[model samples]
Target: MRLKILGFTTLMALLAACGGGNGGTNPPPASNTLSGTVRLGNKASSAQIASSGRLLTSDQEEFVPGEVIVRFKPSLSVQSVSSLSVGGVSLQRVRALGLESTGLYRASTDTAGTLRLVQGLRARGDVLWAQPNFIQRALKTPNDEFYPYQWHYPAINLPQAWDIEDGTSSPVTVAVVDTGVLVQHPDFAGKLLPGYDFITDPRQSNDGDGRDANADDPGDEPGGDSSYHGSHVAGTIAAATNNGTGTAGISWGAKIVPVRVLGVGGGTLADIADGMLWAAGVSVAGIPANPNPAQILNMSLGGKGRCADSPAYQDVINQLLAKGIIVVVAAGNSNEDAANFRPASCSGVITVGATEFQNARARYSNFGPRIDLMAPGGDVQADLNNDNFADGVLSEHRNDAKNDYDYVFYNGTSMAAPHVAGVIALMKSKKPALTGAEALDILRRTAHPLDGTACTGQGPDSHPGSDCGAGLIDAFAALQALDGGGGTNPNPDFTLSLSPNSLVIPPGSSANTTLTVTRSGGFSDSLSLSLKGAPNGVTGSLNPSGNSATLTLNVAASVKPGSYALTLEAAGGGKTKTASLSLAVGTSAAKPTLEGAYVIACFYLGNDCDQIKSRIIQVKGQTSGPYSFGDLAAGDYLLFGWKDLDGDKDVSAGDYLGAYVENGQIALVRPSKSGLNFALEEVQGTGMLLDQVQHALRSLRSR
Candidate 1:
């Protein structure tokens, strides 16, 4: 649980809203406009308006938000109403306001209205934004995202990469140790076995009066709030796919065991330690015995501290590994060296880092000697499609209140860690007898070297030494490496060399070089030549395939000049040999003019919603239509705007926002004339209110 200082005004307002009113002033029946936030012990609900001048008691069977209405009349002259009854069913009374004698209280058959009323009472009128839970939706593709299951000359494209292989009947169980899982999610419905909640705060672990399992604390948030993070993580590992709904996950066939350890903000090392033990099937005091033991444990959370090889933490991790369970942890997102984080940097567990779809290290990923493998964490800046702008995954977060079902795009090592875990599950499913070391070897050996860099102890380009273990993980290559024959060296000895050794080339210009190879151990066939290093906006290629290959490199006129190295490799006899050459490139003084409009579309909380016309901004000096700029230096830039498109002061989701540079250079297109059009999309739903309550309650206490 986390705690925050509630300002005096906010605190007074809450007290007055809940306690100041004396019974009988007979406040007018709460108005249909009656909207407020309700604090349940430590947890708070989203702000909602009473629909049809009525509210539903918590126990009503059909009260859905925006669908139902029920009203309560406090006893006259009563200090406060403590309870109320509806349809013969009694519920704890909520602080009532907005009563008018002439206003007739009417009840609607709609349950959504009642839910809205309850939400209003919980939020106290302040509505926060909401987004969809992405993690819950993305966990459908278990192996395809991490491992290539079959081998083909060029790799065959299948309708769905994640299809269950025949003859695989066994199912594996993996424990998700973080926030609690949404066992109720359609993807995980029946698959979520009973689990334990070790959160010390009673208010947060209570589980919202849902099903009774081994144990339940209100949750990490003091008042029974659930951390969507855990659910997101769990979804990444075992969300069912092909259900014709949301995103896909990695392990569609696997079962998830939710072990709630960190709550609200986070949990202590001790609680995490306990959670680990329980997750690994180890018997512990005070916890109900796990009826179903987990073979793999997915821990997507960690702290920044040197790995303390202390007997306590080590013993717990070691025991799990000894039992044949592979533990996966995230390489922290601090962007600092990974050596600073504990457990992740600790031995006995697989430490994973983030990479973009292109297999490049994520700009924010932590790098160090300890990182074992890299997986697709998606780049916020890289154009996922060739559309020319960065696009990636967007999921639900615990931030928004009003549209709690909405989701946003977030990039971090946290997203990368689970990809590795899901891949492990696929390997386990393929070869159930594979040991942890064997599985690690399969994953590491198959990784594609980033930019032709050697996979020895030395790191790839940009990252020298052991920073990026092996290189970028290649699902296709790893599966091929498992086939055995590829392991044999194709070429024994054939060295290729490049000239200019090192020289600068201007952008948009080509540099030609000759490759000379000396044959020794064997005769070389046509050599398959490839160029590995060049900065973004620069392109390089090898000409003439054979023992003697020619090299041609082009640096985009907009390329940012920088020092780089490329490796030229020769192959024959099932073996490969490589030689490196260095070069420097300078960017062009000219920038490509950019003028385009993008149709902004988005789905929030599983709903299609639009608020675009209000948010689009026109660049200064540029007309409302398409426009462009001339030459500009290579550097970072941003676009900014805020409902100001219409000169409005408030910045709402559909409100126009301008862009401003956060980091990096905009060289591919004209920086000066380049302009980005904004299209805003927002998700809608009430589920976000649940997230807010959890966050608030968690903020009120310490775990």
Candidate 2:
């Protein structure tokens, strides 16, 4: 029931699309009114009427309670629409729009029966739409001048999303678990919520106490300087935005619940784990329940370790997931795969990597399968945007010598995680019921894959490289997906290639390949190149970091003969694209290949269709009758072959797409199912997207 601008063009589009023609002479189709929410033609004017004399304070109200705006059928007069009565209650027309003759009116009812009457009006044949006069919030953009330099917000498309919802109405709390926050910073002024200090060791808490409720920063610097790390992170997520102050925050309307977990010398695992649960609303023995539990938790800290090794931390994450609270953690800043980090590697959390201003993975940002996505953590070296400012993220900081608050730019995965945390705030503000898994999926599905390139190999000796996550977090795109839309930047609309698609070499020998990128679609941006995947005992390197480069693959003398597949990604101008490379160490003749036009894999039994994973192959254009899919693990699986017609990469009803059915299931204990074959058949969309998919897999038993 958000009060939006509802443009004239949009109204016409809705009328035309919903079968309402002749200037609302006909009622909108039932399908259009299924949601039973109020619809308004002029949202801005309506908001002005509602907020004319309302009190403006920190505890500001978003919408008028116990009231709804109703638009009667065009045939009905304004007087007639307002004269309506329900259940012995008379509706009052407090305001009207569209010349006094039209039927739009803002009506009032007692709070006791507001919900019931609103629903009843929506069902009336005389009513066109009945919507609650939802409290409208001002666009949540901050007026801090330095906000222009904070390029991270635009990189993730935050501004576009702010127009839809500023996250003010929903009381979504984001718990920042870090060193501590400078509560007096101007940017964080009335936004701080009551938080707790979890540092049990008095020496580390630096407050001369242990486990207290005061969550203030005591400055974690060794030389008595303020670390400001926690404060910086907090500002990124919920600084006092749009107040014409310092810097704008992402979710300016959401509350900041600061939980001090890390301290002067770094925090212990036990303290961190306990703080996480407490922030999530779980009561720790002897401690009071957190009255304001967070819907989103931001942990911008991590250490080296496979998450599976920590049973205590993993259990807490599961608990938070069940509570519908999303946990976002930073990938370690060690420039290694995030899979080796503790909570970043933990399941049920979204792990974020860092990206430079140029949209390439930040040199220090960790990556790998565990990494969910990337955000601007900042890179000071290259001025891709030529803004004359370092690309590092900017936030509130305490200048020790001045003994006052200031701003500073810092880089790390720690900085990257909060960007995601803030975006989650926006998502939860729009849809409060989103579960942790749903948040991750929405992020992944809407993410702009590394400008169009996949993260690959390291760069040079002086300039280290990074393998990024899915891509940059496009906040606007995510909201669009939540609203049933898709990606907007179709850039990287170019081609990627290797001079030699395949290479052959022997032990102690080397091979050279040329990586090239061909730009198209008016794309003239310089591209950054990266490589990934060299077989065991073989290493690959790209000479330079641009559109075209030479790749050198050095094979160790101890390496065995085999074939390997490698990936190359190119990023630039807010776009990323990728191409695959193949290398042969000695011989690939011994490798087993699957025979199929298209391949489908169903794993993790229960005979679950939900777990069904499929791949479409090109057979009609291939000169060979049979194709081989390499190296699948041993398991009981169901395989299918299909001719993809719609090119959506999935089987759907609208297209002539068909899949193989008979004798598709196989037991690949070893080389047993090598020669299996099947044909394709037409199927409906329901078969591809229905309950069968969800029924295929069951949850893994936690220890």
Which candidate ranks first by lDDT, i.e. highest?
2
Off by over 4 Å in 1: 1-168, 203-227, 381-408, 451-462, 479-703
Task: Give the CA lDDT, 0 to 100, for residue 314 in model 1.
Answer: 57
C-alpha TM-scores of all predictions: 0.44, 0.50
Query: TM-score: which candidate is best?
Result: 2
Off by over 4 Å in 2: 1-145, 381-383, 451-467, 487-703
lDDT of 1 by residue, 1-703 (tens): 0113233344334333332121111232222111111110111111220011111121212111222111222223212435433332233422221121001112332443333333332222121111000011111111111112111101111113233321124567888887776554555555577787765444434444322343322334453223466665665666665565544456666777887765545654445666787777776554666788887887777655455422234556887888888988877665657776656777878887766555566666677768877665555554555644343333323332342332334455666676677666766765678677776776766554343232221123255424655555544444444455232222234456654344445567776667777543124355665666555776667767444566777777676666567666666556677767655554456321112211111111111112211111112222233222212122222222222221222221111222221111111111222234432111011122223222232232221
Candidate 2 matches the true fold with a TM-score of 0.50
Candidate 2: minimum summed lDDT over ten consecutive residues — where? 34-43
Residue 123 of model 1, lDDT score: 26
